[model samples]
Target: MTEAALTISHLSIHDRSGAALVDDVSLSVPRGGVLTLIGETGSGKSLIAQAVFGLLPAGLSVSGTITIGGHESIPASEPKRLAALWREQIMLIPQEPSAALDPTMRVKRQMALAGLQEEAIKPALAAFDLPGSTADAYPFTLSGGMAQRVLVASALGVGAPIIVADEPTKGLDSDRVTQAIAALKRLSAAGRSLLVITHDRRLAEELPGELAIIRNGRVVEHGPSAGLLSAPQSDYARTWLAADPRHWPRCHRCCDMTSLALSAHGLSFGWPKGGMLFEDLDLHLPKGGVLAISGPSGSGKSTLGDILLGLRRPMAGSVEWGGLDIVAMPSAIPPLRQRYQKLHQDPITAFVPHLTFARQFLALEDVKSGLSAARDLPPLLERLKVNHRLMNRRPCEVSGGEAQRLALARILLLDPVAIVADEPTSRLDPVVQRETMQLLRATVDQQGLGLVLISHDQPLLAAIADEHLALGPRA
Candidate 1:
């Protein structure tokens, strides 16, 4: 048998209290082969990747043998040795592209720092469908999908022997996802081993490799991707596969056009240094309705949401709520702002990392009028199907799905009339994504709340949106 490029033997990870997070997991990736890990949120798939790269948090304890390129070491004991392997032998395309990039540096400089030669930066960006102008842009100026492509381009450009990509297509639209898959395939074709962790079923189906279905820290099933995806042996694996957004039943909700909750007229917005994103755009959302926006990366989907929510001033337009133009009323901003809320793509950023959710809720009650008298946390938690125990933990201690649900709960406390959800489930697993959308739909139905959902997932939009708006490139 040919030697494997990477191997994990009897790997187990435990939290500070000795409770196992990953239990006796073993896997291998042959030279030039791919090993894809599919599981629900908090399933320990990313934890295994972190252990291999020695990126696990300080309190966690690891017991495992990770062999990379014929060199063996215990991840728990040999921190420096594993650190030495980064970039040259292995590179991680992290799940959170925004966090992975440096805010201060330009994209071209970051690529150069990732071991790409100065001359190679433009072609590398172009390979990921990023324009030459993207090379000079800062990370913060890029959209979530744009940042994801930048990270993928830079990471793959390094020519590492082993690449561990966690949710590499997290924020990309369908077309960019295809581009990313092509890049990964090229790396594999070049004889580099890959360990891809993702919740994207399309990626799993397209990338031919060994598949491992992880659940609650255990690898419940492992086989060839084609065989397992076609005929999975385990029940959990079956459920996971069935939860893809593509398999979801389409929503038949009809839009109610009479009572407008929010409306935008002749909206035009663009950055001072940039060209117009959209001009003379109009939108309408009735009470208890969903208005979904979709487009290519950097096509102003999120920007339009920001304008409606009053986060950004449109060069020319008015946003009206309840028949009143809120955009023109700067003095009413204090109370009016509470009526419109936003659920961010990354919920972790919406929360304070060090503060517990319970404390944050209390803080919100203190500031927001009538919030304390309106609702309690327990009922909201129950409604969202979140565990009460999670309220005691900080945002960083919970999974992305849990944090997002909690963010929703926080927004609910404000008793908002409308919500602008910007890819709220982009990072979530399929099952959790479905659940979150269901909850959002329920909220819209039950409370007569308007929702402006910005997303790249077509199936999800087809499943829940009452109205669809497709944005194009800036005029």
Candidate 2:
């Protein structure tokens, strides 16, 4: 076996209140090799990566020995020493850009903090296919995929010998995924070690690596990448592998061609800088039909959503919903919302942070039926598999999966004639992804609602969408 580049022994992390989030887990990545740590949501995979980098949250207890190269082992308690080695010897590609990036700072300024000069930033951004001007944009102004690429570029900028990428492929499109995989492979070829923590099996299969399946904060399976991934010995591994979109069977639900639920005619949009995204674009979604829109990062998919929802004024075009032009009648939203709703990609951010899930649901129900909807909520929440007790907790307390389901439940309560979901499952685990898609398919069919699924998840779109509208480059 190759000599170890990064190794962790008996690592454990606990919350301030004494709850153990990560158990005694141990793993190693050989020099120039990659090891993917796979796990379901909340399985503590990212937490382990944080522990390795000595970036755990305040008041969390950590016990471990992290050794880099043949250097002396470093304990988690020595923050200064670990900080010294952080960028030069080891680096982290965080899962959520919101966490790693400073919202107040411009993207370029943030990269500068990592010791990247303007000259360095140009090449790095270009390498990731990001525009040079993107450096001046704030984190919130950038798309999720754009933010993700910024993080990747910063990690590469640091020239670390060892990289821990947590869900590095999240929010990326197919072309972007290919580029990221190629970049990581090149790094490995150049003798750098990588610890990739993800729930994406396809990405894992493509990267040069071994498999380390983590569950409940422990390493449950560790073996050769090809063999273990192709024929996983453990049930968790097998189930996870099967959840890949490639393995999913065709969805049986067919498209209904008779009635039109939504129509966009003569649509045209252009960036302020220059160039049009799409012009005279025509699209339609029949009642109870699924229209999946897909394309590369920065491609106008989400922009189209905003236009369709009347949130953005298109250069030219009218979105007709039930023969009414919502774009022209901004005052009609109150009643029109009953037949139109949106489930944003980051549902938690869309939710009222201070309000409990129950209160949020109740408030919407009250808007619909005074107080009668309260009697109907329990059964609906049960059908969605949402715990009643969780309703009392705020959005921040729920898992990503839970928050997504809750968002869906809220939309269902609204009884909309159609719903536009933008990358709804981008942040979920494979298991949750499957479950969420299945629920969406069933809900669309049963409720006879129009569904516009906007995502870069091609396999998922292929399996679920009745008709896919390709956006971007072609746009």
Candidate 3:
């Protein structure tokens, strides 16, 4: 048997308020083997990863011996050696993939941060089937999935023995998930240990080897993958098992039975020198239905949403809303669009930090130009589960989930025929994610509004969207 690369004995961590986030927990990882950490939100799976890398937040206390490399144990406390050790011995793959990547830096700069060569990134990019130019593009320019893959490549470039994979598949489509899992397996085959942490049960099942279930900061169960998955002991494990994607299959069952509420024919869009982000692409969203556009990062899903929302005029083709072409309609006629609201990829950037939700939603007029916006705001906020108290708080004062809810509420007040949401659930917790998607799907359905959900989350999309149009490399 291979030697254990990392071992945690009686590890415990607590936050500023003296609340224990990661209770006394122990785990052992053999070198080059795959051990997945499975749990739900606030389960402290990420706390374990953060503690390993000396990334605990302010006022947080940690105690434990982190054994690495031939019994030379380091208590996460030794700042100097631990910092150096962090850069070399144990590397971290962060929870937020986008944050790990710099919007300003090119891939070369990121490679340099991890003491790697820019030229060698090609193989890493290729492992995820990314184009050769992937290493040359900026993070903002890359699609969500591409940006995610780049971060993984950067981690691999660092060449650490143990990798703490934290929800690495977030903002990725199913095909990319396949690529990521296969790549991790290849790394394991190359004698590198992997600790895959996720709430995605299907992902845990795909990983070969043992599985450890963590709940409320402690390991509730640990054993062989199949043994744990087939018949979990703890209620938490059973809950996670129930959430597994294996129970849900049959791609796009919602598509066939639903009618197209909103659609585009011969839809093509482009810029000065680049190829069309969307070219002759056709799609549809049934009334009160979702149409998921799943694609690799940067494949024009956002552009397509903008095109459909009449935000960006396409170079060619037209978008039909209900019965009329929203894009080609004569602007001479007043009240340009009947129903459309857009929530962009970055809600934080889109929000006015100083403005309260009530004030923001209050800005919507019966008519954007001259006519009053047709709908009222109170029930819209209620439907999204945004509290009346939360309405008074500024965008910055609220959580990401709350801000997104208000963003949706603001759109809801517009009383549009469709809601074009880009990465709506990307950064939210799974439970919050499901709730948000469910709320939006329900709202759109009841209001007769079409939902054009542009996302990389397959399982979430599967539940809400009637049909999916695959784009980018996988398409």
Candidate 4:
């Protein structure tokens, strides 16, 4: 048998209140093997990965023995020693690519700082299909998928012996996801050990090795990936696998298309430096309609949604809502602005980082009474499956999926006439994703609200969308 590259035994983690987050879990990754951890959001999957790298937040206590390269260390006792192994020995591809990337630095520069040689940077980006010009662009300018690829490229280029990728394919399209999997397979083939944490069953299935199904802070199922995924032993694992979007029941399209909620004509947009993304595009979202936009990374799916919402200007077109040219009106007017809302792809950037969620929710101007009232908040939280305790924590403290649900809840509270959701459920687990999409469909049906969705998830789009628009490279 091949020697173990990394081993964890009797691992447990606790939050500040002495609540166990990860409970007595043990796992091993042999050299040249891949180990995947699949579970629901906030089920301690990320906590385990954080503990492995000694990057857990302050006030969280850990009791764990992590062995790497034959050296064993207690996580709580020797955090610095574990952290010292970063870059050269182990690298982490974080869950939120936007937060992990440096906003001010160019892409190539960031890769170089990650220990990728200058000459290798171009080839690395190219491997992910990133354009040559992307090397000079700042992180803020890249699409969510582009940013994710950049992070993956940077981390993998460091040649670390062990890699812990947390939701590495979160926002990628089908093609890009396949590319990522291929890259990871190559790494394992070259004798590097990988510990991947994700909610994506497709990713788990592709990286066949050891699979551990975690639930409520414990390893409920552990076995070979092929056998377990094909026939899970635990009830929770069965439910999770069933929740895959591929198996989702097709949603009936019941929207009234008689009247328009949003429309765009002769739309054209492009970056000054990168040339045009899309042009002469026309779109319509009827009252209570669902229009989904899909495309490869950096194809401007989100940009199109932004144009329809009046958040951005198309170079040569007009966007109309309720027969008024919203493109010509000021975007900040309360009446118009409140009627149109957006759910950002990166929920972390959607709120003030320093403030708690409760404060942010309370600060929203109540459209009905012109006062901040959180009276309707409880039911919304319950419907979204968000715990009330999370409201007290700051944005950075919560999981990405939790923050996404909160963002949706906040938008729902406004009672908007339309919502432009940019990959809103990408961070959520499969089960929660189905629930949230169902809620959105119900809301649209009941309130006659229009929805403009941008996603790379083909199964999800197939299950939910009324009309689909696919964008691609300009001819």
Candidate 5:
């Protein structure tokens, strides 16, 4: 019998406090085949991946046998051996590309460091739908999707037979998501083994692979992707499938656009090297209106959001906030920003990492009454499905969905009149995505606040946006 490309037998991992993060799990990825792990946030999917890479948190106890490509199982505790094996054998496509790449290094040099020739790297770049010029660009200049593709390219350059990608398509728009799926498909077709971990069941369903359903550190279900998605046996899997956005009930709220809220006129933005990203672009979001900005990756959606929120200045334009020209008043920018909040793609980074959720919430308000805050915050927290138990813990201790909802709650507490949410639901599961967007939509209407939703998701935009702007290359 042919040996599996990657195998984990009776794997268990425990935290310092003796809590089992991963309980006795067994899985395998056959050579040239794809295996996907689908689970909710905090279900131990990432811990499993970390275990395979021998990069688990300090003080954690691991009892596992991990074999790669017919090699004997190596104890995961040996850091030097695991580090060497990791570099030479198992290629990891990390969750956040921006964090993985060196900001100072050129993409070409980084790929070269992975031990691949330019000839070998070019095709991989092309396969991932990245331009040849991407190799010459700095990590800071690449959009989230572009950076993600570069990471994939770097892994492919190493020519490792086994690839482990964690949330590879997280925060991408539909276009970038499609490109990522295509790239993964191409990689698997070329006889490389893949272990993809994601919360996006839609992504799992679309990929050509077997599927494993994990919940609370256990694999509850395992089967072919088609069969599992079509008729999931487990209750959690069935609930997850039923909650997919494609099957979600649609009831879009109409925005009240009786008065002007925010507007940008003659907006012309140009990067230092890229020249003009957009010229004379006009945008308007009325009171209680939603204007979704949709575009391909690297097409300046986030840049436009930055300009609107005063985080970045446009080359030539006037942004009017409630009839006041923000560009004309530099000193007022800071105060006005409080009223026009921005929600980033990664909510955790948007938060104060050192502060607990309760502390963060208190910081938003002028009222110092703890009793009042305790009485007021829980109902809203419950509405958003954020556990009150997490209030004591820092942002890093919470899941992505929880962090995102907490961020939204924070913005709402500030009593903002307008909001610029950049891909707010991109990292959440389908159920959470629907819930969060619906909640956001309801909040916008209830507060009569203007919302500029920037994303690449056409279906999501269509579902909630009252107005749409499609961005593309310059004329």
Candidate 6:
């Protein structure tokens, strides 16, 4: 029999709107076992973590007891207790690793703060595919992938007995993701407890223990991993599984329609300070068509997306929008901000954190006034299929998928002649990814908007795109 390490009962959390973010939730973690908390964003999974560790933001309130290590009171009000708890026994591999990790400090210095000695830092880096020499480099100086490994490495070095990993692999590649997962298994095997918080069912399935599905703040289902995944008993579980990437279907209808909405002529673009990110490059997106720009991470796809939006000027070559050089037509540039929109890779950081959804929408409204802006909500929400009910909720109050959908909706509202999206599916699970692309495609078709999707994820592209182009090998 396993020993209980963490316990919760009748846990509930509410946002400023007084809506229960986590309705009634309860679960337990055995000492030396791994328990994954899986749920969509705004489903109260993160709140549970915050409640357990006492880390919720200001003004938010939580109820019910979160007992850790048999103590009824977590003593979260005591910083010394929280800090000590963090360094010695429990830790969080935070959801946003980049944000959690300080960009100023050197990797080795950060690792030392987590309890590892400088001499031991090399081994830690090696464990996560980081160079042994990375200890000397600052966090911002490292690549996104490198930064992620450091985040995990710092937490692991602390020798925390219980860890709450929230989307720990946000910036990691597949190989590093595997390594991180294996490391978690090793921790569990060694008598440390872990609660992996993620939306990825596949990762949840691979852990050597139980799966608990939480939705709208309740434990909707709990059972052995294999059985629950193979034959889910709950509707929420089934919906989640259906949304998994493995079950997603590609859009076949989108292929029949294509009418060139944007094209490039001898497009040679480079940095004046001189890095030829793209040189003598050419690509096109048909009217109402979905064109996916695919490649590995950091391959300059986002750079090209920014260029297309006229946010950056190219040193050479030309980009033709409707057969006219948009660079030369300074006249159309003003309206283009509304006509050409972009949804960045990360949704949470992309939004103004403190603003409520209504406030953010109002700011957008301030850009282009009147009732016509209100015209965007219904069809936009219906097409995107986001709950129109969630319109008033703050960005922090909503789920990750919901936030992504909202970001997409804002782009749709602008009704640009061309839409340039950067990795719209990277943060989403398989099912959501496919559904989102379909919605994006449908929006483009109905409005005759051009779509250019930038991503390193292939399966998503295979599902919705009319044409595929890789950056370095692009034609």
Ranked by lDDT from best down, the candidates are 4, 1, 2, 5, 6, 3
Kindly report which residue stretches of model 6 are placed more than 4 angstroms away from their true locations once superposed.
Answer: 70-72, 75-84, 131-146, 253-259, 264-280, 312-318, 323-335, 369-375, 382-393, 429-434, 471-475
Tens digits of per-residue lDDT, candidate 1, 185-294, equal: 99898888999999999999999789999988899999999999999998888888788777888765776889888999999888766688888999999988999999
Q: Taking the tens digit of each residue's C-alpha lDDT, what string does model 6 give over 292-353?
A: 88654334676778778777766666776656687777566676567677787667667788
Per-residue lDDT, model 1, residue 6, is 88
Against the reference, the lDDT scores of all candidates come to: 0.86, 0.81, 0.71, 0.86, 0.80, 0.71
Prediction 4 global C-alpha lDDT: 0.86
Per-residue lDDT over 229-341 for candidate 3, one digit per residue giving the tens place of the 0 to 100 score: 88888886776565433344433334432555677888876655446666787777777667788777667788788777777788778777656786788462235354667
Write model 4 residue lDDT over 356-438, tens digit each, in one string.
89889988864545544467889899999998988877887777888899999989888888899999989888888889999
Quick one: how many clashes does candidate 6 have? 6
TM-score of each: 0.95, 0.88, 0.76, 0.95, 0.90, 0.85
As for TM-score, the candidate ahead, 1 or 6, is 1
Q: Write the per-residue lDDT of candidate 2 for residues 1-475, one digit (tens) a residue.
A: 6889998888888755566668888899998899988877666787788777777756568888888866788886666777778877888888778767899999999998886877899898988898888898889867788889998888777777899898888889988888788778877888889999887767888887788988777889998888888888889888887888877888856666668778889999987773688889889888888999998877788888888777788899888887887777767656777778888877778789888787787787557765444687788778766667668678765556567778888888777788889888876778768877888888888878888999998899988899989886622
Clashing residue pairs for model 6: 41-399, 42-399, 243-431, 245-430, 268-280, 339-416
The best candidate in terms of lDDT = 4
Superposition TM-score, candidate 1 onto the true structure: 0.95
Per-model tally of clashing residue pairs: 0, 0, 13, 0, 0, 6
Question: Candidate 1: how many backbone clashes?
Answer: 0
- The lowest-lDDT stretch of 10 consecutive residues in candidate 6 is 75-84
Ten residues in sequence with the least summed lDDT for candidate 4: 365-374
lDDT for 308 (candidate 3): 79
Off by over 4 Å in 4: 331-334, 365-374
